[model samples]
Target: MLAVIQSSIREYPLKPQHLLPLALATVLIGCAPSPDEELNATLPQLSLKELLPQAVANEYCNPKLDSDLLYGIGYQLYNDDKPEQARSCLIMAAPTHDRALCYLASIAEQDSSKDSAERDRQAFGYMAYSAVKNDSCAEFGMFQNFTYGMRGQTPDIDLGLRWLERSARHGDADAQQTLVRLHSNKGNLPLAYSWAKVLDDQAQIDALKQRMNPQQLSEGEQGFEQLSKIVTSKDAVRKEAREENIAVYSANIHMEYPETFKGLSVAERHALMEQAVATVSARPEFSTRGQFYAYVIIAQQAQLKQTGVDVLQNPQIVELLSDTELEVSEAVKKADVILGQAAL
Candidate 1:
């Protein structure tokens, strides 16, 4: 054991001063072990839930460990599917509210049962509302609003647009594109033009100009052609599935933020993206065709950026179409064929 000795350095000569050092020495020797070593030695005896709070208390009040540790613990709980526990861990870490809100939204979306869905929806709504207050990337808030009917508690296009616009203002490219699509479908040419202008590609802008009225576009025929190509394109399916999975998983991962990976640097972002793709790729529920659709959506987004229209006609888009585009179309064809066979 490490120990210290309390001896008087000054010559005493029977003086009263010598007694002062002697008295204090006895008291100092009694309590010498550092608090941390003692805690670490005893920690194994406690339950994980108990130990988690203890770790949080140490990290929060002791000022020894980095704050990122808080997020790490919260992420562990989240991945374990213990959202309530994860929430507490994150709260103690005091991570961003937006991350917490995203977690709440994910939990709601994952539940299929009606009663559970309602409870999850309410919980998600409260957090998403809080999240949207801080960041527009929290447009996941609009998704929640659309799905659950909060505020006035009825689905309203006006309210949806208000939220989407709020997200768009925050520089979300997705929201900007979504607005263009919605306006185009509604035959609001002026609104579509306004939103489409925000895109980086000039070609896409011109294509938006060529957009026929909703009535003129054959939903079934055009959609069928697109679907047929998706299934046949291997590269397209891989990219699409990977991206879609990443988006969904990233959204789920976002739910655990601040407490799970709050200060994540760019390197960490790429690692998590890779992990999310792997997780989605392994899921049997996500068929190859489904994966193809996911890629088609991505290719379409790329096309829309480069050409300004959802329907791609550019040479580059055409080249990508035969490659990724064909994969997506094939996937769609397979789905249609499967459905037809099932009906028979």
Candidate 2:
């Protein structure tokens, strides 16, 4: 079964241009700029308040400043070693942004200034909120919180595993990877194979095959089929589409403006791109699903000198834009399919 799937999957091997020079790699890997230095170089010289206004701060889920931009800014600030600023922005974003809440939980957990009890309380609070919102990362965080026993909670391995499974079902790569290892370690080869198949970790799958008999492998294949449908359902597809859209847009922007992004870490670059996408998303003209697709298409065609006119010319885009009845999820699926085709 694994071999059959592997045969059909397209391999995207790394190209020569993808590799950094050995000297440059050494400098980046061993002697990268300090957080402060990176902050000064990459970010504009503006006060936090100027970048994020008090009015927006006061409003939870502010329409003027959307959650994505707030989270993006907060994420960048956190990466730049400015936890205080990150906390402020993340708090504002957390009402509607699960990832922001998860970040807040992490920030609280890592704060040396806080007492352990206080840290646990804050971390648990943020994680709980994010979990309610169905954020896979937060679900995984909750699993950790429960497994380790926080300030007000006792360790419950059963409950932790439940959360871990929930996170895996919600399409968290980390959670899926962890489940594969946990099950494999516990001699549950069938369960392990199911998750490994979902993750497309061919090496792990192959290793598990060596351990499992034919019956166990067949059961695993059945589990994989069931899990695939759940993970590839409409909600999951929309979640994946939104993430990929931001990632591709960000990568395109980085490619187009390498000088502006020089010396930035991958996380930092993605943070900046998130903010850029948020800004573009907030524009009135791009409010509709069709318009958003157009923006993404333009970004995708950055090196090709493709203009808005070219994007508008796309038949799928035209059809999508014309369909006023399409729900966001449907539109998202359509857009993702279009993007996948473009990639090919």
Best candidate according to lDDT: 2
Residue-pair clashes per candidate? 27, 0
Reference-based lDDT, residue 333, model 2? 60
Instruction: Return the top candidate by TM-score.
Output: 2
lDDT of 2 by residue, 225-257 (tens): 766755535466465657655643443333333
Q: What are the lDDT figures for the candidates, one per model?
A: 0.43, 0.59
- Stretches off by above 4 angstroms in model 2 are 1-64, 150-152, 232-344
Q: After superposition, how far is residue 198 of candidate 1 from its true place, in Å?
A: 2.1
User: Candidate 1 lDDT (Cα, whole model)?
Assistant: 0.43
TM-score, cand. 1: 0.37
lDDT of 2: 0.59
Clashing pairs in 2: none
